[model samples]
Every structure is written in C-alpha cells, then in structure tokens.
Target: PGPFAVNTATFVGYNLGGFLGAAMATLGVVLPSFLIILIIARFVYNFLEYRTIRAGFEGVKAVVVGLIFAVVLNLLEKNIFGGTLAFKNADFVALGIMLFVLVLKLVFKKKLSAIAIIVISGILGLIFYGMFPL
Candidate 1:
C-alpha cells in the first residue's frame, strides 16, 4: 500500500466528498509513511557505512524489482492474454497497441514525451474499441 493506496483513497474520497474528501484521504494514507520515511532518512545515512545495512538495502532493491516484474506479468495475463497465456484466448488488439507503444519507444527513444505516448495510445484505443469495436 503506497501510491496505489493513496490514489485509490483519493478517488474514493472524491466520489464520496468532493475535493475535501480527496485531500483528507490522501493525507490519511500518506502521512504515516511520510513520517516513517522521514525518521528513517535522518538515521539511514549514518547506518549506510555499515556492511549489514548496505547489504540489506541491496536485497531490498532486488525484491522491489522482482515485485514489479510480477505485477507486470499479472497485468499482461489479465489484460492482454485475457487471464491465460494461450494464443486462442489472447486479446490481439490490446497486444497490438502494446507493441505499437513499445515500437514508438524504441524508435523515438527520449524524443517522445510520456504525454505523447499516452495520447497516441488513447487514440488507438478509441479507434479500435470505441469507433470500430473490433
């Protein structure tokens, strides 16, 4: 529960109580973690010189990468593959859009802004799902 929790709370609060609800929900979710991280940051640099602390941080870095990979796989399974890896069940249009964005990233590299990619993807989505429905 980090950014996702904060975002979820914000949206739910907005639905329930407008701007004030969103503000409260975001603060409620973030304040505790913010304080804890603030406290940790103050002492963490001092402890960084110790080998055990450095090694623990390194392990944490690896675990975070693994967790991100797992989440990506889960999203691909549910969205592009329609809950399975079988080709027959795959959503080819969604896969096409993903590949298109990847190709744009590869070709454009740093030239393309995230907003441009988002706009392009949104147009593709509208064309495929809304206008054509195929």
Candidate 2:
C-alpha cells in the first residue's frame, strides 16, 4: 500500500553519522563565500549613494570583470579541454559549438532567453535520440 524495499540496515546504519557529516562539510565549503558576498553586497549598498562611492564602484566593476574572466578561463580549461580526453563521439564537439554560439549570443546581448535555448536543445536531443514509445 505504501512502499516496498529490500533491507540494507547494515549498510545504512553503518554510516548514520554520514548525513550530519555532509552538513558540516557543506557549511565548511560555503561559509567563506557566503560571508564574503554578504560583506561586499552590504558595503556596496551602504555606500552607493555617494559620488566617490560611485567612482569606486567603477573600479570594483573592473576588478569583478577580471575575476569573472579568470573564472571562465579556468572553467574552460578544466571542462572542455582537460580532465579525461575522449574524442570518439560527437558530444564534445556539439558542446563546443553550442558554447561558442551561446557566448556570441551573450556578448551581442541577443534577445534569447535561457529557457528557449534549453528547450530547443532538448527537442533536438530528443529528435536525434528518438522519443520513447508508450
């Protein structure tokens, strides 16, 4: 009526503390970033009304841009070209083409929304893979 399952009590209870450990692990990883964002956003909101603060924001924006560029470059190096190399299939090439088009779209400030892009890609994938008959 409700549910059915096989028993794995030994496996499950053997790591009962694992769930609490995950919470501690997540807080450790995220606490610094959260505190930094809170401090930065608070400072910006507090000071943005002044002319000097506005001038300082422009410098902050340039630093933010450099940080964003470095992050993007690191992501590209790790995901697209690094890690494990596999060129036997066309998935990676397709991903590269999709990424290039998306970057161009963003740079030009094109009027396409993320949902539209995702839906179109999903439909293309379904067409190529064939829908399940049910």
Candidate 3:
C-alpha cells in the first residue's frame, strides 16, 4: 500500500491488530497506574476520613504547593527577570507575557480547562513562529 488510511471516526472500519496494538500499549502503560490509583482510593477511604490523616495530607499538600511556588519564583527571578532589565530585553519580554497570562486568569476568575489552554497556546506559538521567523 502506498498510503495507509483508516477511518478513525468509525470503530468497525479498522483492523484488529492495529486496535489490539493500541489496546496493548494502553494496558501496558495504565495497568500499573490503575492499580496504584485503586490502592490510593482504598487508602483514602480508610485513612482520609480520620482527623490525623486529614491533617497529615493537608500538610503534605501545603508542602508540595510551597515547593512548586519556590521553583516558580526561582525561575521568574533568575530566567525571566534576570540581573539587569536595562541590559536584557528577551527575559523582560517573557516576564511580561507571564504577567499578562496571570493577570488574564485572575481577572477572568473562571475555571479554564488545561486542554483548551494548551491547544490555544500551541496554535498561537505556531502562528507567531511561522509568521515571524527571527
């Protein structure tokens, strides 16, 4: 075959081996995660309802958040803002873009889907990069 084509919208139009290849890959990747999630769910039911476990989880969540915040702050301070804004322009421009997004999210105050954001960002990146090659 010069070109392999399959109707993705129709389930019955595809081959079994191709379908099983997808299913096998999915099973290989997800089985361990599914088992882990099942175990975590069981643990949540058993432990999370209690005061001690609840507090411990809350503290753990806080620590994780703090770690992420610190990483973000470090990135912004070092990479985005840089040492001297008067000398550098690209870092300042990136920092401005980050601030713009943060302001947009804050002003909108609506739950935005990560998928939609990612898709839009990727499309915008492609358009900008294609239109202005520098």
Give the whole-model CA lDDT for all candidates, comma-separated: 0.78, 0.62, 0.61
lDDT at position 54, candidate 3: 92
Provide TM-scores for the models: 0.44, 0.38, 0.49
Worst 10 residues of 3 by lDDT: 1-10
- Tens digit per residue, CA lDDT, model 1, 1-134: 57789899999999999999999988889999889989999999999999999999999989986996699788768866675543343476556657577747754776766467768777876876678754
Query: Who wins the lDDT comparison?
Result: 1
lDDT per residue, candidate 2, 36-117, as tens digits?
9889998877788899989987898899879977996887677667876543457755755675576557645866664676
CA error at residue 96 for candidate 2, angstroms: 3.7
lDDT of 3 by residue, 50-94 (tens): 999899988997998699679968877886577754325565466
**Model 1 stretches with alpha carbons more than 4 Å out:** 1-33, 83-134
Question: What's the residue-level lDDT of 110 in candidate 3?
Answer: 59
Task: Report the CA-based lDDT of candidate 3 relative to the real structure.
Answer: 0.61
Candidate 2 residue spans exceeding 4 A from truth: 1-46, 80-83, 86-90, 110-134
In candidate 3, which residue pairs clash? none
Error of 2 at 125 (Å): 12
How displaced is residue 120 in candidate 1, in Å? 14
Report RMSD for candidate 1. Answer: 6.9
Give the clash count for each candidate. 0, 0, 0
